[model samples]
Target: MNKKSNAVLRLIGILLLTIAFCVLGYLNAKNIKLGLDLNGGVSITYQTVEENPTAEQMSDTVYKLQMKAQSYSTEAQVYQEGKNRINIDIPGATDANEILAELGEPGTLQFADEDGNVLLTGDDVKTATAGMTNQNNNREYVIELHFTEAGATKFAEATKNNVGKRIFIIYNNEVISSPNVKEAITGGQASISPIESYEQAQKIASTIRIGALPVSLTELRSNVIGATLGAEAISTSLQAAAIGIALVMLFMLCVYRIPGLAASLALFMYVGLEMVLMQAFEVTLTLPGIAGIILSIGMAVDANVIIFTRIKEEIGAGNSVEKAIKSGFEKALSAILDGNITTLIAAAVLYIRGSGTVKGFATTLAIGIIISLITALFVTRGLLTAFFALGATNPKLYGIKKETKVINFIGFRRIAYSISSLVIIVGFIFLAMNKKNTGDIFNYDLDFKGGSSTTITFDKDLSMMEIDSEVIPLFTAATGGNASTQAAKVAGTNEVIIKTRTMTTEERTKLYDSLQEKFSISEDKIVTENISGAVSTEMKKDAVWALLIAIFCMLIYIWIRFTDIKFASASVMALSHDVLITVTFYAVLRWAVGSNFIACILTIVGYSINATIVIFDRIRENLHNGSKKKGLEYVVNEAISSTVTRSINTSLTTFISVFVLYIFGVSSIRDFTLPLMVGIVAGAWSSVCIAGPLWFDFVILSKRKKEQLSKK
Candidate 1:
């Protein structure tokens, strides 16, 4: 075949693959499970009656609760919170009261003879299932129970001695059922038949399952999340993402022309494949998870940007277009691998240690990073190659880099260090002042600090936007700080739940009066309760451990890859700088340090390290090519100078994606993206100004130490 014909065939194959994935993604989009925040659901926490529950007890309770919850929805998740708390999240559920009612109070279950002799406890039961039996054209609900070997043997002896006697099933010290034994029952399974209804039988089954828990549980708090916020969030997020993708595509096309077109196509494939993979993996998509996808979109663009920039440099060095393309990819490999691998490590750690939304975010992020790497490395390459073969190989289309002098980033290190230290110091000062004044540093939202949840049945229905603009402000004003609102998801209900910092009785009464005065709500319609933080102490500890482990792993990887501890040390220092600065923004602005805080901080850790590694990779390259003879200062400066464009462009593209999300997203999303924006800028700044200079300082100190040791 001719070159043109082969190119056409490759292009056709690319088009086919893109279409296939896009079609699959579109068809399976609904199959992607949305989180409670996005789908509206019930979030309930149960506290063990025991003050210090054993780990085995907690684990058993969590497992039983998970099985019970899964009966309601397969996507249900039950996880241990603190030592004595178990949290159940059932998405796609409305009416928290109904769910709580059906879930029942978890306590002991016992099967006793009519003489009140205990025969079996819940611990002997393996599982319970509610079913129906047809007899003589009549359907009767039944609760089937399967028992352990010991329970089966015990039941056989009991039934053999007490044939035709009634056996009472007691749950929580209440007689739930009494079934007569017709004969000796030897099998491990038994059924209670002729129940009134399936719901009743199912209730019994659920009770039995929960009763199997080793620890008794009391309801601590229950939240009925409305679908409105999620609907608005999803809609607006999609809009923002679409606009951001279009903007990115336009920017890429305007800058790199043909290669940009190739990248845009690869981006499409990336999204399509991401959706398919997420569905395949059954990864739950939360708001932060969406942020992960969009951020990865930016990162996907970053990989392309890195390669295209290198290709331009190669072409600018007067190489042929085809050779430049190959050389550019080869040269960009290490930075790309190091950056991506570090992020993957973070994601893996988070997935392993984190729970709930944190796990969700980690899963999506890990998948996105993998897919982005593949698309950028393979799909983009194939498209570029086919385009090249089809005769679109003008250097002008890709643009040539002009010769530029090396910037002395090292000379400005002192100023950079001073500025960073000033910002961080001011942040700490503010934190101290806030702690002294309010007894807390960084405004803790309901997700972190626990708060009062007030459910109000208003006279008229209100949309999420209206509630945000009108109702939540009143609550915030009453509470003297931030407040969150959720409309009830139940049909024909005009209820809205408002959450704020824990309030006094007087404050609650005042807020109730305000609501009555404004919306003419009845005093009886308002219900209030104090709820604990959703981000439990255990989760916080897990996040910290995940971050610590991720950083340690990344440091080791960078040390091995660069063959120097200084590069890894310098990179970690730069990461610390970005994190502290971003936290400074949070403290100064008093951004609500909520669940998204963990995601934001971890993201900065991953992002800052990626940028730092890029610079370090360049420095390693320069040193390998014997650029170190000029001096460590020159080597660092030249590396920073050479990669400055890539750093700025990558940061800007990522920033643009997140910026648009902030601009167009709902309040919750804005809360997430704002700090992310700060972190991105901080990451870029530290990578450029901090990492290289810090490495230079490290080398200088090492030499001084060696000289002193030798002299001594």
Candidate 2:
């Protein structure tokens, strides 16, 4: 085919693929499940009554709970929280009482003789499931049971001796069914028939499954999440995201002009493809996950920004547009790979080791990175090529690369190090003071600390702002300002659920009376619950371990790729610097450290490492190209100077997206986005200033030490 004909065909192919993804994404959008935090649901935490439960016991309990939860909904999640606590989250469930009633106790199941002598216990039962059987040409529900070898032998003996006698199936000390033994059955399989309905059979099956729990459990906390809260959050978040994305697209087009327009088109494809993948993979979308997606959108743009900048530089160097495009993508490949790989490493570790919403955040981030890579490297490149072929060859439209001088980054390395150290030390001091004042290292919210949640129905609907200003003050004053409050207004209703530190009886009464007097809420419309902390001590340990592992993994990857411990060490230090600074913001500001806090911290780690990698990639390239001809200081300075614009531009775009989220989002979302914005700035600073200089110092000192050793 002619060159023009080939270009037309490729463009048509790209258009078709884009249209297919859009259609698929739209069709599967409804299949994406919103997590409990986004949609009203029942969140229940159970503590093992058995003291010092073993890992196996905890695992068994969690598995049983997961099975029980699955009976409630396919999207239900059951996972261990702390050492001996299990958290069950059932999305789309609004009635806490109903869920509790249906779940019942994690009671033991036993087979007994007529006199109530126990023959076998639930431990003997291998599996139980609800099944349908044909009886007398009618469909009847039944519970199919399978037993272990020992249990089967015992059951056979019992049935043989008790033929024509009645045996009772008992649960929680209550006789559920008694059937006469007809024969000495030697088989391990049996069936409980004559069940009235499938629902009842399924309930019995679930109960039987619960019998596998090696230890008993006590309800630590139960929460009834209103669906309206999540629905409204989704609506507001979507609106904000739409607006932010539109602004980003406009900015890209106006700045890069034609090339920027091509990137904008590619970004749309990335979004559509990401949505379709989320639905196909059944990844849960939580509020934090949405934040992750927004962050990754900025990252997606960063890749394009790097490529475009390189293209501009090549064109300025007097290369043809086609040649510049090829060279630009080639030159940008190393930086893009290193940056995305580092971030991907963090996401992978988080997904493997993190739990609950942390996993969701990691999953979304990983998906976003992968999709962004595809779109940026292939989709955007193809589209840009097509546009150029169709007559977008103006160098001015693509942007001109201005000549720039290298800044002496090494000369000011000490000052940068001192400033970063001072900030970090101050952050630690704030944490120490916070620990002393509050008896906790940070201001942990209800999700991290067991608290009392009060749901109050007012005569009139109140906005979150009104509740914060009018009602929260009453609670704060009552608790001597020691209480932290989080309130969410139930959508389509005048009810709000307010969570605060555990309240005494007197405090509860005082708060109820105050609400009644202030808002004229009826006594009958108010309800209070003592909720267990979602992040148990063990869960916190897991989170810490996950982070450590992530950092270690990134270190190994950098060392292997760069073949230098200095680069790896510098990168990790930069990541730690970003995290500590962000943590300081939380501590000094006394921000409520909740579930989202974990997501925020991990995000900073990923983002900071990405920025660090970009600079380091440039340094490695310069080192390889310059060899020993260039001094360490010159190489480091040049590397930093070359990538400084990228660091600033990427950070600015990411900050803009998150800043918009904070501005337009609700209180909970604002809390998440605020810290994220700070982290983005910190990551950028460390990448441009700290990472390169630190590596330079390491290289310079090492060489000097080698020379001294040679003299010796």
For lDDT, the strongest prediction is: 1
Per-residue CA lDDT of model 1 for 109-173, tens digit only, reads 99899889998999988778789999999988999988889989988887888888899989989
Model 2, position 122, has a per-residue lDDT of: 85
Worst 10 residues of 2 by lDDT: 224-233
C-alpha lDDT of candidate 2 relative to the true structure: 0.81
Cα RMSDs of all predictions? 9.7, 8.9
| TM-scores, one per candidate | 0.80, 0.78
In model 2, which regions exceed 4 Å deviation? 43-87, 93-214, 218-225, 228-230, 455-497, 504-506, 518-527
User: Could you tell me the TM-score of candidate 1?
Assistant: 0.80
User: Relative to the unseen true structure, what is the C-alpha lDDT of residue 588 in candidate 2, on a scale of 0 to 100?
Assistant: 88
- Displacement of residue 41 (Cα, Å) in model 1 is 2.0
lDDT score, residue 487, model 1? Answer: 39
